[model samples]
Target chain A: MMKIDVSLSKRLGDFDWQARFSAEGGQLGVFGPSGSGKSTLMNLLAGLLKPDSGHIRLDGSPIFESASSINLPPEKRRIGVVFQHAHLFPHMGVRRNLLYGFRRTPANERRIDTNDLIEALNLGPLLDRGVKRLSGGERQRVALGRTLLACPRLILMDEPLTGLDEGLKYQIIPYLKQVFNRFEIPYIFISHSLNEMRLMTDRVLEFAQGEMTGEVSSELLARRGMGTGQGGYSNLMEMGRLREDDGLYIYRWGGQEICLSNGGDQDTGMFEIMSKDITLFKRHPEASSARNMLQCRVVKVFEAGNRIGVELDCHGQRLMSQVVGSAVRDLGLEPGSAIIAVIKASAFRRLY
Target chain B: MFEFSPTDWQAISLSAQVAITATAVSLPFGFMAAYLLVFSRLPGKALLDSLINLPLVLPPVVVGYLLLLSLGSEGWLGAMLAKVGIRIIFTWKAAVIASMVVGFPLLVRSIRIGMEQIDDHLIQASRTLGAHWHDTLLSVILPLSGRAILAGASLMFARSLGEFGATIILAGNIPGVTQTIPLAIYDYTSTPGGDRMALGLCLVSIVLSFGVLVLNEGLVRRFRKGVK
Candidate 1:
């Protein structure tokens, strides 16, 4: 099993970044905001940057140890790195660059099929082309092919898709997923986008303020709050049920009830509630047509740009409401604030 | 009008020999110095850089004078060398030394730029492929920087062909031995009514320079295309 157990502390200007982690052969996605030290961790793992104090072990081999005075150069580490800019050798043709690592592979240990790799990456047409002539997406594809041809023990990618447009990202992400699935070689992918991480990562290490907070199974963590389904606000509408009392209708979710303005025969079955449609109030307001109002307590507050997401525990389930930061502060809302969450009946729609 | 003398042919042959010898002796040193400048993290890099470029700024006659003071017979180091029967003063070998000293900087600077321009990521990728340092240098670095090396060599060859001041200071005017193209041109121009001979030799030098420039341009263009 390919494993990495390394710690590094570096002081760059005003920022002190310290990282330590270990994992075996698996896809590990380093997810964090910009300037959170994700790329620094990858560089340390690749032996591109030496740690101030620590040891790095790859498999059973000691790649680096401060105590033993053993520091393997990047070329000796057998760790492949794909930069955000692709970093292909402009002086060599695509075929030459691809064959560069292949030629270095020892004859006795060489296992890569050059022709098969070329065909698999759709690089046949690009074999003879100059690296400078390839488009952005095309260059990244060739870079991936070049790294793969090396047959490295581990691959480190540093935000490879950060600069690409949406169309290019979409086109290349599927190919990346396919390559990762087909090859058992361990890969450490660094990305900032939640959507991209969800689609590609198997495991995730959350980074904040230059430290790794924790490791979580991408599937499980995503399912809890950010996943495609179950438990989160997006899935709450699916579990929602409508109940009529007198002329008013209430949407019953778990033990809490949200009264809606109208619940006619046209309204049917369980639906989903988008976090965007819900709003929080410091106290109950009188004379309102909106009927789905329930008492809840704030649990967590997350800030992204100009918006703040307020996590609330209503009844026995968690509900998230997106609100403006100004509004959140104006209401003097904190983690323990008792608030009313209002949602219109029209906001809850049945999910097919 | 086109009368050619045997001495002139001998001078041409001597010039070719001196130029080839200078390039052959200096190419390896140029590559090493260039690589060190490009890749090493040694302290006082700027000092070394300035020292390499010192010859470029100094008058060629001054450079030859320094070489003579150090390597000439009866000189400090020269006296020791003379005991070993290695006399360099006023000889054809001195001409090759002069040319090499004059051409070394041009070659090293060009090749250093080439080495510096290489993407470090390619080197890292090569290493991860299980290739050692030697293998990576040969397969990746050398091939990627081939054009720059060629450019350096070509510039050195052309510079060596045209060298004069240092060659004259070290290797005195000796026909069929140390007399190169520039010296031959000087000789013909100094003679009464030998303008035609001097013009013919001048034309040859022009053609050679033109040929090298064209070849350099072609190599660069081809390299650019290959990189793309």
Candidate 2:
């Protein structure tokens, strides 16, 4: 397994960031709000910035260490980086720019073929054209080809698609996927958009307030969560609503309560309960059909918006039910009424 | 109805020889100094920059006086070099040296700006491809800055051709030997009934200046087109 173990702490004017994380060989996406220290972390990894105090190791090889006094310059790091702006040299033709790195590599260590790169990037027609003549997408393609030709151990992409339009972003995302999959080299891709992260990465490291929260599987947030009232009552009740006091949310069911620790998103206090965990009942069933049933009145009903958000009220608490709109109307639910809310014991998960 | 003078032709040849020699001798030094100024974080950088540009601000005659103090026969370097049988005072070589001193600052400044304009990421890209500093400079930096180098060369050549004050001080005005076009024109204008000769040399100087300007423009245009 190719592993990256690094800890970087830096101070830029008034803002400060001290990030630490490790990942095995895979497509690791770094997601955060703007200026959340994503680019700074990448710069540190690429040897462009030296950490105030820490060590960076790639597969046990020391790239940087403050104690040992080992700090490799950017040129010696064997890390390839593609900037947001495709910084191709304007004076050189496309072929010359692409071959610049390839020509510098020692013959014995050079693994990539020049022709293969040209064909793969569809650069034959552009080879003779100067870089200033290339379109934005074309420039990025050449930049990617240039980075690939270098045979880097790790690739760092700093918002490679930030300025492109939606149509162009969609067009280039697939090509990026193909390149990443073909090389199978470890990549730390920086993106602010959650949708792009979902489509492009397998693992995501979230940054907020200058610290890495943790790595999360991309599948965790891929689909919308089933709200409170729509899904089976057992699941909804088990995944409790956000409590205002102490900022801790708890789901209680079947003599068990799970507490959720805060993981940075304090604003827009939203949490997701799984659809499969909710147990729906027709009436106010007593005696134990499920744990934690609320006498909720149906508020507004619509096609659960992704078949998941059915709004309802349970004892002055506004709740969302993830269910088919047909189910809401089938029960003849109307404003200001009473029904039983059944929540499963298992679907209560505390998001971090 | 054509009147041609052998002395006029001799002055033209001498000026051409001095300009060529000045440019040739100073080209490598200009490149090195310019590269250092752009890429190095050395101490006294601002002082060095001001020192290089001193000739452009000071009168050319003052520069000649300084050069003479250091290079003339009883002077520090001149006396030491005399021991090796190398005499530069009042010779054509001394004229070339005078031209070079005046022309160098422009060359270095232009080339240094060109080197600064190169996108630093391009150099980093070369390094990731396993290229060391030397290879990166050779394959990337030099080619990218070729137009700037050309522009600098043209300016240096033009400035060297027009150099008069320093050249006259270090190398005495001698027709067909050390005297260049500018000096020859001055020589003719001072003498009685030499107005036509002075006018001919003036026209030659104007033509040379115009040619260099056109060549510089053409090079810049071609480079811009290549970039596009």
Candidate 3:
């Protein structure tokens, strides 16, 4: 059980930021808009930045206390960070970069085996490669391995998968989950995408301006228009298995089979289907380009500004669809009403 | 036959020794000054900056005169040295001191450029990875700034080889004692039918400076390739 109690105030150029938060968890997600003090809070927690007047404690150890005039340097604070750009040492190869922190830690205190971490992060093949030769995904994987080998009590990741394309995101998410589950240490994953947070954890702390406004579950926040990419909403689904047919991949989900763009080895993970990508049809439309059609019962309908949010139950799985309010009234969508939801194969965003 | 007199050989060897000693002595202090200028937030930073750069804009004769006042036999520091029965004036030590005073700004400028080019995130990343400031300085900053350090050392070494105004005023042109390559060349140029000897010494100075430049470039290339 780890706890973080932060009450700090600092002034940036032309902007003043005040942040206060207390949380205990395995994974806590920090979600806020750009320049809302999320990164500042992370820096403060990592001891890279000092607060003017506050006290910070990690599991009852005083990392920083302004009243007591005590502040530990970042190296002694035992916090590892995975920056947005990885920031691997340019002069070192992948092998040396990973071993940098491992060798620094006391031998008796080392918890992570060097070989095991390399295998887990798939860094064995790229160990001797120079840092300049790594691709974006490969660099991030190395960064994760390096941070893990540090044996830090708490790891803070700042938008680990922000700029990656869709395919790379699918490839990276599984490694993130692998590290998180293997290490018993808690982590703070910071991102603005609610859908991405849903794949990692449900406990999210929301920030606005410079304050912790409230807390909400990932699903509930997604329902409130806090989804991925440009105010979009997505329904994250779990798949059981996949079948290959005619160069297409089919996923068996909710007692039904759905076809997707790619196939992977493990099939038990979440997939994000954007809410706006699904179309409603009164009956099963024939000769359509859409791949999967599921017969779902409307669980609830609510007004979402100019559009309406319709929550559907596909067997036991929940799928959300956003439709124009006029279409809702014309098709008579309500609780217990049965309708067909059509989705394209390209719309399925797999999050391993 | 290109014959060099014993006095000529002495001046060449002495010039080489003085220049090497000046560069070696100023290296650590130059790095410290550059690091503080670029990284630290000293209280009297403006005043310190102007003082460090004063050598660059001032005349070498003036610099030599200031050194004379501070380190000559009658000066305060010179009196302190005299108390210990050590003499620096009109000696090889004074030549080294004058060369160091004239070449210091170039050394500091190149090192400061190198230190400023380093990325701040790399230092922060090192600290987060459990390396203290000392570790970061040794492992990250020093290795990355190697090319600049070499460049600065070479520049100062070449500059000291050609130094004339400061050395003549402080160390004097005493053959076989304090006279260096430039002083030897000056003596030959003033005497009758001494053009040949002066020209030979000038060629020697040119070859030495060219060798240092080539070594500097070669090492910088090797260092960059190693990092890559």
Candidate 4:
């Protein structure tokens, strides 16, 4: 477990930022748009930048405090950073890059075994290859593996997946999830992507301008973001593996079999469907173009901006769907109202 | 066809010795200067930059004269070294010093270019990964700047081989002891009917310098391949 408590302020040119917050261990996220001082916050936490007059602590041990003029260098502070672009040493091979931090750390402080990290990150084949030879996804995995080998108390990722293309970005998520699952090290993920926030972080600290505007859970942040009208509320579902049939992948999701197109036969069966893509019918249509229809009852009706987000319970599984206020009135989307949600086979997008 | 004398052989050997010594001895200092220029936040950096580059802009003869003042017997640095019974004037060592001073700016410039191209995040990543500053320098910065260092060393070595104005002023044109290729060529050119020997030595100078340039080019290519 890890805990972070920081109250810091720094003025860069015309920008003034003051942030104070304390968070306990978990997949915490720093969510903000560009130029919002998120990188500055990361630098301060990693000891890469100094806070003008403030204190920063991890697990109750102070790493920086202006009152006593105590500022530990980044090396002294057991914090690791995975940058947006995988800054693997160009001169070293994958093995050496992975072992760099491990070698520098003392024997006693090292708790993570090298072999386990390599295996968890699936870096075995790429070990002998130079970092430049690896693809974009491969480089990121090596960067993460390298940082994990150092056994840092907390990892601060500054948009680690930003530069990767859409397919490559999500392709690395499972490796990241596997490493974090295999190792219990706490990490603070920083990104501007709300989809990434929902997938990776349980709690999020929102930043706007130069100050931290609010603290929110990832669920609330996702719900609050539904008002943007850009593909409202994405529902993440874990579909159990099944055999492919008739050019479509069949999977078990929420105690119901669902058909998905463009879902390749990868071991990772996680998929996401946008709330806007899910159409609701008061009664099952005798014939429809959409492939999967699941009978659901409205568990809650929450208001997100002008749109209404209908939370549904189907076979003890939760799914979110959004509709206009008029549609909600017409469909009678109240708690305990039975409705069938129609989803096209093409709507299911694989997460990883 | 040319007839070479034993003194010409001495000049040839001495030229290589002086150039090699100057390049080898100046490498560490050059690397540090490049590091300072590229990375350090020290005050008066601009002044240090100008001072190191002064010899590049100044005439070599003027550089030799200034160095003569600094290392002369009556000068402060020379006086301090004189207490240790180490005399450096009018010797092959003086030629080495002259070449080093003249060739330093080129070395530093090449290395600074390489160092500047390195991403700031790589260094930051190293520090956060539990590496000390020096550790990062040796492990990260050093290897990344390696190709540039080789290129710089080769440039300086070639420059030293053809060094004429400063070598003439500082080390003098003694036939065997202090005379190098350039000094010897000067002597041959001045003597009546010695143009053949001067032309022969000029060929040697071209071959030596061209060899260094080719070797440097090959090394840079290999380093780039290794990085890739």
* Candidate structures ordered by DockQ, highest first: 4, 3, 2, 1
Q: Under the 3 Å rule for N, CA and C atoms, how many clashes does model 3 have? A: 0
lDDT of 3 by residue, B1-228 (tens): 467999999999999999999999999999888888988879998888889889888898898898889888789999999999988889999999999988999999988877887888788888888998889888888878888899899989999999999899899999999999999999999999999999999999999999988987786676557544
lDDT of 4 at A168: 72
Off by over 4 Å in 4: A242-248, A262-268, B217-228
Candidate 3: the clashing residue pairs are: none
What lDDT score is found at residue A156 in candidate 3? 91
Error in Å for residue A185 of model 4: 0.2
Write candidate 4's Cα lDDT for B1-228 as tens digits. 766789999999999999999999999999999999999988999999999999999999999888788888998888999999988888899999999999999999988877887889999999999999999999999999999899899989999998888878888888888899988898889999899999999988889989999998887787667545
C-alpha TM-score for every candidate: 0.74, 0.75, 0.93, 0.95
The candidate maximizing DockQ is: 4
Candidate 3 residue spans exceeding 4 A from truth: A226-231, A265-270, A281-291, B214-228
Per-residue alpha-carbon lDDT of model 2 for B107-209, expressed as tens digits?
Answer: 8987887788777777766666567777767777788778878988888899988899999999989877888888988988999988887887888899998
Global Cα lDDT for candidate 2: 0.74
Judged by lDDT, which candidate is best? 4
For residue A85, give model 4's deviation from the true position in Å. Answer: 1.4
- For candidate 3, write residues A186-233 as lDDT tens digits: 888898866678777788888888777787877777777733334357
Best by TM-score: 4
For model 3 the TM-score comes to 0.93
